[model samples]
Target: MKYCYYILSVSLLILIFSCDDKVDLEQFIDDSEELTLVYSSISPQDTILKVRVLKTLSSDNNIEINNSDAFVIPNAVITLSDATNNSVRLSYNSDDKNYQIEATQLEILPGATYFLSVMVDQREFTSSCTIPNNAVTELAFELTDNLNNAGDLKESVTIRFLDIPEASNNYIVGARIEDDAFDLFLDFENRRFITDQIEDGALLASFGFFNNNPDSVTDITLQVANVEPILYDSLFASYSNKENRQNPFYEVIIPPNNIEGENAYGVFAGFQITERLITYQ
Candidate 1:
């Protein structure tokens, strides 16, 4: 597909904070309970499934403290089964902390139901959802015809959504781009940075880059997650008010485009309960 070009300016700033004066507290604290796995492909209609695991801080009475050392279930074994019960095992990538069932592992026919079974730390978690028939989302990137006084490419690209509701308050957003000729998932914390409220029935944002050669964009894809009804409503207010200035999101710089050909990008968006979402409800 041919990419589009646009010109815009985007600026990023880093803020730091500090606290003083401490109160005495207990030296020992109990660890939080293991997170329960909530499995589903980011898009129910696609064979390329994305799964998420989460646990609430208040779920277990024995677990009282906040946060845990283990963000991801290590060495977890995950399997995906189609409507016919044919299954395939997903490989766990420690660096990304996700059990990825590649597109080649299973052929997802439109309208088929897929089940995901996860085993981590001796606990079993299972869930299933149907994939939608339409395309999950599309991403495009291009260089602006405009140039700075120094003759550098001054351009920005806005990844847009199709068939996504503009009034939808509940969603998680993510994106993946081609790196080293392979699709590398962007870190969750970093992807959160690009996230913002979808106002007036549409979600729109822009990212600016400086380059002498505008032909360097290999690929870009944006993904949106499902927001549970309750959590979705809360975000409508929180994001609208901007109560927290902290950008839980992250931005990664992709080195000049080294990949070639109609390079493809993937967006992984899913619905899973998070501690914040659970507690707020």
Candidate 2:
């Protein structure tokens, strides 16, 4: 059974360019290949491993990529192993179209390395990532007001955290409303990545939060994620170069993918997130 498989990693970017210049897109479409894409991120807080595998599609294809079954690769052999040689092979769940490890034997811990391998179409592709030790010692938030470009008072948040350097530690912080009150922002917003290049051990880090709601009162959860160096670099590229995926005038930037193999892109990352809920009025 041949299913319409749109690689999730590549599909989102391709759709942004579908209505743009067809002449340029023709070359990209023609150059497209059926590459095996692997995207998985694991954390100890989560119960099961959710891995997505898909094949790339052409820009000219009319299949709706948003369809639940749009680009799912079924019944692929997938395995994940940690540095201590604790490994678990995943089984495919047709309902969610994701490869999952149900036994929960794998522990995603800081300073641990994880390797993921996928067997598809007679090709074996692999990617590895390490989990960084917890760097956030303490976290506190304060409300503040800032003047936007229009000279109007805008609400913002001030976040402060104590850091413990862990081999060039990199961090991404953000906040989101706990409930479904505001549809303006995603569950996680105000995303920013920072490194301890300037601030060393026992350093104090502070930054202003990017809040969309000006005067709204709600409960917001702050997220502090300790991302590995490799994964940090890839996310940094994806976050910084987001415009490359859009704007028709500039060439799209292919966000760094840690996967190792021919014609494949994506990351197998591990994250340790610490959250604190704050009531703001």
| Candidate with best TM-score | 2
Deviating ranges (above 4 Å) for candidate 1? 1-33, 37-69, 136-281
Deviation in angstroms for 51 in model 2?
2.0
Write the residue-wise lDDT of candidate 2 on 158-237 in tens digits: 66676665466667666555444544322122235666778677544434433345345467666666666656666556
Model 2 ranges with Cα > 4 A deviation: 1-7, 10-30, 93-97, 148-152, 184-191, 202-217, 244-252
Please give, for residues 116-232, the per-residue lDDT of candidate 1 as tens digits. Answer: 666756666565554434332544433334444457555533333433454333444444343454323322222233323544435443333322232443554444444333323
Which 10 successive residues of model 2 have the least lDDT summed? 14-23
Candidate number with greatest lDDT: 2
- Which residue pairs show backbone clashes in model 2? 5-71, 6-71
| lDDT: worst 10-residue window of model 1 | 9-18
List per-candidate RMSD values in Å: 16.9, 6.7
